[model samples]
Target chain A: MLDLSTIREGDSLPTVVKPPISRSTLALFAGGSGDHNPIHIDIDYAKQAGFDDVFAHGMLSMAYLGQLLTNWAPQQALRSYSVRFRAITHIGDEISCSGRVSEVFQENDEPRVRIELTAANQNGDVKLIGEAVIAVY
Target chain B: MIDRSNIGKSFPPYAVEVENHQLRLFAKAIGETNEVYTDEKAAAAQGYSALPAPPTFGFSLSLSKPNVFEAYEALGIDLSRLLHGEQKFDYIAPIHVGDVITLHEKITDIFEKPEKRLEFIVIQTSLVNQHNEHVGEMTNTLVIKN
Candidate 1:
């Protein structure tokens, strides 16, 4: 898990790789999570929905950020993390997941670390914007 | 066609707990091979209290709840026709192990087109703690087809 004593504000850890979004990723997200929205997996169905192509699941993108946090804190101990779906992530889009230590504080007698999180595509269009709170033990 | 009245109607309250093993299972299935999700030490080095739930972790928080769907079927809308129009959340705090979250649901909005056989219900859920601290809110538009 996460040890707060070792972290510092603006302390950037080893940069992680931002993977490319693939149709296969969407298929897996649909099958594994049971999301299965045609707009997210079938190109023809997506076109009918007014999309240019199949889009990645919004949760799949959010999952990337969660993966990033787990690297910082461990066994799904996150108190809470939230986001707004801003744009459609088309297949083959390159999404870069990045975060910066936005704040460190104390709440309810517990140490807390707040970070502003986001996933942006190669075109610099942001797909999601959100925050995560980690309670230090 | 789905009933217009059910558009803004919220079913009931439900809750789901985040378990460590389940978190690991999701991470592995999603191809999140990092130690932070799979190993405790990697998470510690990165500065975590434990294995962090993946960001979309909010889904697991409110996924399967007992009896709430009874209200959906009561409307006579086919469950399979429901499509998630969107999913969004706001993280107000961190959820640790043993944290049992209660989800309060409300139908925020509903729309029906005269020529369309479907109705859209804007479903909103607030995941709160026992003390009522807001944990997160999940909003999605469900398409109800006849």
Candidate 2:
């Protein structure tokens, strides 16, 4: 459990890494997210589309970042979470998400914290990067 | 090239019913092990009236609209060449299980970078619960590789 009282600016968040994503993970995400874009789950279609092979949904990486946030803070405290897809994450790529406190401030008399976040593959090529603003009080 | 005339267009609003099982499934897919996301008892223990939506849950709910892709097709976009460029969410209020949330999609902006042969369209969707409270807003940018 995260204690807002103990958190300070510049503190590093616990890194969360997911196992290498598989075709089955992408397929399950397709069903769960309602994103049936063949480019994500169908190898032939992905190849036909010029990609080397199927890739995970961009949202999947964003979800990993989200998991990192909610695990360290209260779910209801998230005020904003955003990300930009930087690189394609192919199947079997292990994505690791991490973040650091950017600042601690007050808004409407409530304590808030801003965190800069990143999700990168084993090669260190970032798959996504963004920030999350949370209400810590 | 996608027709630029679709800018500022708004699609009909659609609704998606929040369900605990779906939330649990999504959590599992993303490798989320937090019990609050999958167990009602854990959520209640944490003070949530119901299982609070995972931070990115709104993205999945917004895509459930049946005609979400029709607007892109109408703009002459090649769905296969489309790529997600960016996504942002502003959580104004918590979304709880059992909320029949409505999603309203609006085409906020569209532009192109001729040198890069890329066209970008930004769609913003707002979520309102059955009680008519604004819950969240999600912005998605689709990059069409031209």
lDDT of 2 by residue, A1-137 (tens): 45678998999999999999999999989988778888998889988988889999999999999989988888778889999998889888999999999999888788899999999999888999999998876
lDDT, candidates in the order shown: 0.68, 0.89
lDDT of each residue in B31-137, candidate 2, tens digit only: 87999888889999989889888888898898787766776788888878999999999988888899999999888999999999999999999999999999999
Error of 1 at B33 (Å): 1.1
Q: For candidate 1, what is the DockQ? A: 0.20
Native-to-model Cα distance after best TM-score fit, residue A15 in candidate 1, in Å: 3.8
What's the TM-score of chain B for every model shown? 0.80, 0.94
Which pairs clash in model 2?
Answer: none
Off by over 4 Å in 1: A1-6, A75-77, B1-8, B12-25, B35-55, B58-104, B108-122, B126-146
DockQ for candidate 2, C-alpha atoms: 0.84
